[model samples]
Target: MADSITTIGFDADDTLWQNEQFFRSSERQFAAMLAPYFDGDDLMDRLLAVEKRNLQYYGFGIKGFTLSLVETAIEVTEGNIPASVIADILAAGREMLWHPVETLPHVTETLEGLADRYRLVLITKGDLFDQERKLAQSGLGDFFDAIEIVSDKDRSTYERIFTQHGDGPRHAVMVGNSLKSDVVPAIEAGSWGVFVPHELTWVLEHVDEPVSSSRFRRIETLRALPEVLAEISAAYSAA
Candidate 1:
């Protein structure tokens, strides 16, 4: 229950500010750029495959994605991708890196309300520089007790975060859009996992929905979170 929990970790990107939507838009643009030589859907699918394969080498971020886009274009076009097309791909990456960090509806306000009463930490996974840049520009950095931009989210990662915060798993909760990245691992690591679904999740992040567990919950939106926590805490206190 919420009352028993002392530390809360939030995933950045879609959970706090706009992220995947930009990537989705960029993918469409990339596909359109290559529409002459390759079918758009096929091109996008190839690009996704390249991204998946390159994830280990490039990790996650705009730079790697831009590189993958270029690589995909070259491969699809048999090394005939024009310089102009390459330039456009690079420009898209720049636009993404420079895009305004728009905090989602009620995200900052929710953090504000919760920060006053509980320890809040940001536990996001991405390129270090890009993640830090977004956090600096987000204007909500002051609300967090700690910030952890990890390479990935797994059970060990969540366990370490809990240990670092001195809360352990029983006293911590993780909230985010990706069930795979945020909820399941946190729950497996002995913490509460709250799934806040987003409309435009990447297909790669999808998994079967998690069944309800003692420390797992699914909520429609962050707007209902405060009340949810209150109810959980009340139940905890009763127990």
Candidate 2:
């Protein structure tokens, strides 16, 4: 609600569209396929561990995720898995390539409402081709003034974006679903962060600490955004 704020950044993936559900469904299918070799819990644990370890080496995207699935499947089966099983896992990974391509509840309306007042930017990180495909299909693309598909979200990234836009952290706000990739870094960069939790946030995006800053708040749905933004604007004016 700071009066000086004229720019807002948005995270893609789970923020504006359905992303994690695809991964979750894929994981379920993977577990079902691997049940003959190991328990569901153990298999999931190994997959999670592999994903975490690979994030450092491969960053984020379908490539790394697919590789993790392949590696975990091979590891759990102890090299005894059939070629068909491997094919099934690879198919499951490819199935995650396309999502339903619909904006979250209120996301479109909120973006339209905010467009008149703020310079909106779509800032997301992931596989370039897949991310672009989703964005192109979203129909929400036109509302944004800029679209940045980055490799990661960190302080330097935020700084670079703001500088390029001729803005500063104090006058910027970041809205998204991931506490790790969106909210924490935005707050750390001295900007406001609004968290709209999705039903299936990735386990990797989970945060250990509570978000308790005055500059940070959480909303249950995207539909609540316009009113919340209005309140922020009003408060900024009052200050």
Candidate 3:
């Protein structure tokens, strides 16, 4: 797989920088903010449902999440929630957008090593403005030859990104944490999927096993990525 892959696509949020954990933190704050009306657990359940339902309409990222928080507050509390609470939710959303983009362990060095060997791309799904801001702050942005802030991570989306970048799906390898977003779709699109497990993945991105796929594999961390590529190259060379 590594020998065939000339282009490597990375999923930004959790794959590269700290994203979902901050959202989780903000959600905890959100639950606490509305503690007067509903149980924290119940609020979490309700908010998650709202977020899932709103994904199409609001799309992904902080703004959509903030709006969902407001709507969930209204729904669970029957619109009796205070304006100050609404204000606080909006404020929290802003804070999340402006939060420092903390690169994951070995992300910088990994990208640095890969950049010279493959055509690197940042293929992330989120609100454009927020994604762009985070990319700029991440300091690892310069490594990518192309950047894609897509609305969703689907088969067609992966196909289109590879096409636009002039990289055939057969020669592309998509790496990320989410099984649903990064692995499955890339595999379904006829590309290779490399799952790099993250300890704190968002519930929304969870999916079942990639059982039957020969083109799919998992590496424990970013530090292991280069060796995987090297192994692929070596195996193909020996053959």
Candidate 4:
């Protein structure tokens, strides 16, 4: 038997770099800004609701999130939200967009270690411009053989990407923080799904773990990736 995995796909936000923390920070600011308008209302929940409803219209990323914040503010205030407040909200969004990328611990070294051994791909879902900006600033762009900044992640998307970039999902491994977007679908696509949990993952992205799948593996961090891959290879070779 040959090696079970030949290609590796990585998720950008949270997995490779700091992402949801910024959103969390902005959300607290949004809630504080809206607090004076209405007392005891869960503004964060309202914002998340708007975000879910508007995902079709705006997709993901700071721009969409900013629009949702403004919409939530107006709705909560019954169209009485101040223009200055709205300006402040927009400014917050701009600040998030301009925020510098900070790669997670072990990301750079792990990517460098794996780059020589596997066909590496960056597969992430979000606003194209924002994703590209993060990737460019990450200084890890050259490590990947291909970069996929998709609108969403699904089994079909994984199948298409892995097949096109490598030998297909059977020979691929997708590592990321989201169980919904990164792990489950990649497993459904017949690839190994490596889950590396991130503390600040978005609530909407949460899903039950696919623990029963033989192709599924969970690691504490990206630093353990090579060891896990070796284990997978040995297990496959034995069978």
lDDT of 1 by residue, 1-239 (tens): 34487888999988888899999999889888888877645777788899999999998889999999999999999998899999999999999988989888888789989997878999998889899999999998999999998888999999999889746877888899999999999999988889999988888889877786877788887887888777667667887
Quantify all predictions' global Cα lDDT against the true fold: 0.88, 0.84, 0.88, 0.93
lDDT of 4 by residue, 194-213 (tens): 99999888999999999889
Looking at candidate 2, the ten consecutive residues that score lowest on lDDT are 208-217
lDDT of 1 at 156: 98
Between candidates 1 and 4, name the one with more favorable lDDT: 4
- RMSD of candidates 1 onward, in order: 1.8, 1.9, 1.9, 1.1
> What digit string (tens of lDDT, one per residue) describes model 3 on residues 1-239?
34467889999988898888998899889888888877646778888999999999999888999999999999998889999999999999999989988988999999998999889989998899999998999888899999999889899998998878846787788999999999999999988888999889978988986979977879989999887777656655775
Q: Which pairs of residues collide in candidate 1? A: none
Measured by lDDT, the strongest candidate is 4
Worst 10 residues of 4 by lDDT: 38-47
Please report the TM-score between candidate 4 and the true structure.
0.98
Error of 2 at 233 (Å): 2.5
Candidate 1 ranges with C-alpha deviation above 4 Å: 1-3
Cα-based TM-score, every candidate: 0.95, 0.93, 0.95, 0.98
- Which parts of model 2 have CA positions greater than 4 angstroms off? 208-210
Clash count per candidate: 0, 1, 0, 0
